[model samples]
Target: MKIHSIEAGNFKLDGGAMFGVVPKSLWQRTNPADSNNMIDMAARCLLVENGDRLTLIDTGMGNKQSEKFFGYYFMDHIYDLDSSLKKAGFSRDDITDVFLTHLHFDHCGGVIEKKKNDFYEPAFANSTFWTNKEHWKWAIEPNAREKASFLTENIKPIEESGQLNFIKQNSSFATQNEMDFDILFVDGHTEKMMIPHITIGDKTFVYMADLLPTAGHIPIPYVMGYDTRPLLTLDEKSKFLNEAATKGYYLILEHDPNNEIITVKHTEKGVRLDKSLTFNDLFN
Candidate 1:
């Protein structure tokens, strides 16, 4: 199995929102903010190539939204999905499965594209989109707080295209033995957010979707404000970090601008950042 880091471009998000209760004095040290208090973020996706199945983790925010809508997020250095895929030596048609961690606009938006004047269609026509039934229901009928993040243009098209598939809603960890990966379902960030635990050779790479957005979040209390259940996040992070530290799992960060992969260590003050490494450092 081979894994490639696909860059869908960078955007800026409010630092305050990224780090929930952590003071700016603390988080700014790690993720420095701009004049507008927005910090640099990457829509970093992962491409898993195992045998004939090419699976993409997340698509990043697509280019279909209007300029006004995008301006709110301060999206800069935009890199569309198609170009990113091409650079990775593949194309949309090459994708066999799209495993969405959640259905937030920034994560799943690129799965569909603007077709005509108003029509939208799935970007990867041949790929089977994978999202859990629980997450699908939560996203489609989003609550007031998260409604803005779940855009119909990005979601309805997939169901309409007849390519949408749901992973079985298992209360326990769901192992897709066929795909050679297991999913760790987390609810702190969103309802039933599936974090892929992929084992390549001797190492296990856990995709830190929103569960642990960056290495800066390793300190346990640095949960994102966007998380619905912050206390649950704290509990989840504690358990996951301890296990990650024990097993030496390489964390694949999705939104971290600078750092890509990191491993944590069980410190005296709880789990803390150990070291940062690149993809080549692990696979090459």
Candidate 2:
């Protein structure tokens, strides 16, 4: 199996919320904030090409939101879902599976598009949209804290389109064809967020969703302020990072615009980035 970093786009979000308890002075050094204290965030997704399968990990915040809605999160960038896929010698039609980490707008919004009647519909007609049963229920009946992130318009369409498929939460490693993977579930960020660990060319690439968002967040206490269960996130990060360090896993950062992937080293400064470089840096 081969992996390609498919960048959908970039948008702005409040730095304070992104960095959590960490002071602005610290996070600002890695992810510099703009005048409005909004830092640029990547809508980076991953595409897996394993034999006949073309599985898309996540879709970025889509273009379905209205002008007023988009003004809040300055959505502007060189990369877009379709164009990026095309550049990678693929297209939306080629996608066989859509593996969503969760139903959050930034992660799954691009699954659907706004219709002329102001309703949402599936953007990829041929793909089987994948979500765990627990996550689907949580997103549909979202609580006060996560309601904004779980937009019904972005979700309900996959089922309506007759392409929604639920993957059972299991302990045994799950494989769709020969591309075997183990799901690491963590509830700190959101309920049942599935992080996929896949072996690639003698290296394991663990897609670091929101658990460890950027390189700057490596330090234990640097948890995101937006995390629903900050303490749980602390524990999750600690365990995951230690495992990554022990196995020498390459962490694929979802939102880190500058450093795409990095190796971690347990140090006097605690778990920190050992080296910083792009995914191409690894392939080359």
Local accuracy by lDDT, each model: 0.88, 0.86
Best by lDDT: 1
Pairs clashing in candidate 2? Answer: 20-225
Pairs that collide in candidate 1 are none
Residue-wise lDDT of candidate 1 within 166-281, one digit each (tens)? 88755322234444488888999899999888886678889999999877788889999999999999999999999999999999999998899999998789988898999888
lDDT of 1 at 10: 89
lDDT of candidate 2 over 1-33, digit per residue (tens): 678999988888999998888899988988899
- lDDT score for residue 84 of model 2: 91
Candidate 1 residues lying further than 4 Å off, grouped into runs, are: 171-179
Per-model TM-score on C-alpha atoms = 0.95, 0.96
Error of 1 at 75 (Å): 1.6
